[model samples]
Target: MMNNYNKEEIEKLRDLIKDIDTAMLTTSTPEGLLSRPMMTQEVEFDGDLWFFTMKDTDKYREILHDSEVNVSYAGKSYVSVSGKVEIVEDMDKKREYWNKAYEKMLDTSYDDPNLVLLKVNVRSAEYWETGSMTKNAVNLFKKMTGSDEKDPSDMNKTIKF
Candidate 1:
């Protein structure tokens, strides 16, 4: 299925999620479902989600066992993407997205010591956004006076995974 997000709403979601920086990465665990906050370098709405993680970590194992996962980011706007995860070892892709800070934090090069990439093919996603305070107040005022207002995110565009 596709997400029924409109162009304007899509732009709003992109703007919101891009700056959120951190996303809660979720996976199924025997104990139940597990989630961890991960830093996002870039999140493009081009049908796939890309992230980096240590290849030797527990999340990697869980993903291998079951690829179903969700990533969420929220700031002024909120977004949640659900799909399947794949461990990618593409050297070129890694090199393209690599950063010095990542190596500094992980204590190893991007290509070194069991580093792996998590790429998700988004099957579905949801987004919510709030308009400017001025706009919000006007809408509220109108509603209080018995007027209908257009929602900020009801664009009618399908969200591309």
Candidate 2:
């Protein structure tokens, strides 16, 4: 799938998610679907998403059971990414995305053996973005005024990665 992506489309998808600070990572459990907030790695969106996790965590176990997952982000725009995930243990890769805050959040250093990375190899993504603040404000006004017309400034796209 990665081989089929054109440079422009990848950049467009990257632009949509670039400023998102957190993503809701969802995995399937025996009971149902479970979602947890995950800190978004401050790196370029390169057809994959990276996350930090502990080896003993529920998400880790769930991923082992079913590698399929969903990750969603809401900022000025909203993005939902469906992908397959696997546990990654390479220390160098972990260090590349590491930050001091993670130490405080997980109560462990990056060097801890319990530390692991969730590598989400994106399959497909859908995003909805409201073009600009002014346009969004106008849309809001129209909605409040009981206008039934759809806003032209609203944008939506689906990308197969």
Candidate 3:
């Protein structure tokens, strides 16, 4: 069973990543880890991240073989989330996240049987914001001085769900 997430942390994480539209999804493979760029579903995140994929794709097979995954996003900030994925075939959910862009990119409609949703139950996330140079320099100076105190504007943080 999934543990309850802190609402504040969930909201903070959602705000940080909502603007990032694409993510690199990494899945475990027998050989090693495989990663591919996937379009993130434009829905409010509440400890779960969603992506669309084809049933026959390598990612789908990979998820089946090993559910553990990592999703990384880059923008003004960089975020990496660790999670486990579950294949979802709910048509309502597919339609809810579907859009013309997906149709054009996938060359299929939401009703396509091959199209499915990968619901990633996020376990934890680490993020780093690209702060102003002054803040970064100060942080670097603090690190160099071996200061254990964290600045309120510290660029990096980890959130656990």
Q: Highest TM-score: give the candidate number.
A: 3
Candidate 1, residues 1-161, lDDT tens digits: the string is 11554555455456757777789999998899999988776646555668888978899999999999998877776688788987889888888878998888778887775887888877667776666889768777888998856674533223444
Candidate 2 Cα misplacement greater than 4 A, ranges: 1-4, 131-152
Expressed as tens digits, the lDDT of each residue in 36-123 for candidate 2 is 9999888787788889999898889999999999999898789899999978999998889899999899999888899999989888
> Candidates sorted by TM-score, descending order?
3, 2, 1
The C-alpha TM-scores of every prediction are: 0.75, 0.86, 0.87
Clashes of 2: 0
Sort every candidate by lDDT, greatest first: 3, 2, 1
Q: Point to the candidate with the largest lDDT.
A: 3
Question: Which pairs of residues collide in model 2?
Answer: none
Q: Report lDDT per candidate.
A: 0.76, 0.88, 0.91
Winner of 1 and 3 under TM-score = 3
List ranges where model 1 is wrong by over 4 Å. Answer: 1-13, 132-160
Write model 3 residue lDDT over 1-161, tens digit each, in one string.
Answer: 23489888898888889999899999998899989999999888889999999998888998999999999999878899999999999999999999999999999999999999999999999998888888778878889999847766665899988
